[model samples]
Target: MSPRFLCTLIIVLGFVSCGLPAKRREDKTKCPHVKAIRNFDLHELLGSWFVVQYFASSEEALSYGCMRPVFSMSSDRLEVSMNFTYTFTDDPAAELLYGNITWEIPNPSRPSHWVHAEDTYEGVYNTYVLDSDYKSWALLLHCAEKSKSPRYLSSFIMSRQPILAPNVVTYLREKLPRYDIDLAYMFPMTQTNCSNTNRESGLDRDTVRYVIKQSESNRRHPMKRLHKP
Candidate 1:
């Protein structure tokens, strides 16, 4: 073959190689695998979860407090309650703030919700990504709205025990960005008591059970001890 022809052939091959289709790649190093949450069981999902790490830019400030949030499935809808200690920076005296939430199933065919707070101003859409095994730990996503950008809203590292496993922490860090979350400013909760117990029935665990039981009791006539979740 002629040298000129050979050079031309090589150039063509290089172009073809460069243009070839490759698997779509994304920067998911810090994101969680969001698709894994699609199969969550609603019946087993009702309970309280404490916030562990949260993205700064999201509505975490108002949501952050001694008590985080509790989720329950009512019929086909989701009922949520945000419980937290509200401390005025100026006052230093802390007061409790509780906000209620209700979310309808996103699509009739899907178990997801376009959740909003019961109060209008505090409304935001969220998708529950992770449900605790016994409804213990949960990971919530603040999906982007028509007027907003995508964000990782709330990440709760709840457990039957107060403190979560170090492995759980590692898993959360690894999985969040796979769902397009940015964790640059994600903050951990300061209430160590909720995250430092060894017994499964410690403060964190009991808090979750008590909250659910109380809600149920309020609805039902008398108190009943159901199986621990």
Candidate 2:
């Protein structure tokens, strides 16, 4: 296949995977919500979090070793800056995937629980801190959107350090069933070369264009989770 053909194919896949119908599917089970750590300090949570375990159903897999989410306080909401490295299906060299997601605490009583401040197709996107000590390990639950058939859920076990402790991983895994999340679908995310935030490739423009086009397509067809189960 010609290089141009491969490029065009990848662009098509990106848009198709991202573009989906936007219809709210309700989950029969009441959305899961573990109690947020009481009196959790948002200031303590403001910093870079290394994603240890990721549970998502997206068709695209998250790039390993570069999934870092940096958070900072902006007014009444939390500003999130996420950076990662992902490549086209067969391409080896990695490209950057960066975006900002803003979250706000709707209830002052539950400071650790937040809702998407920006428009999100995932109806009722809620992010809650299930457990965290503010120094070592943090367990997070992202209820992306509850669908009628398959629920779209994402949870993360983050840590201050790049690597998570073995015991913590075990504990987080055991906690999945309560939320009806399958442990088999969960996988550890890479934290390699995390310090090198400037990593980029010649295909940066292509990557950006694909992302932009995908986003626009999603706006038109906004109801489905892009990840495949």
> lDDT of each structure?
0.46, 0.62
**C-alpha TM-score for every candidate:** 0.56, 0.66
Model 1 residue 42 CA deviation in Å = 1.1
- Cα shift from native, residue 73, model 2 (Å): 1.7
Q: Which stretches of candidate 1 lie over 4 Å from their true place?
A: 1-17, 20-39, 58-63, 76-91, 112-114, 117-124, 148-154, 192-229
Clashing pairs in 2: 21-223, 22-223, 57-227, 58-227, 58-228, 59-227, 59-228, 65-190, 65-191, 65-192
At residue 156, candidate 2 shows an lDDT of 79
Indicate the residue-level lDDT of 44 in model 2: 85
Native-structure RMSD, model 2: 16.2
Error of 2 at 198 (Å): 11
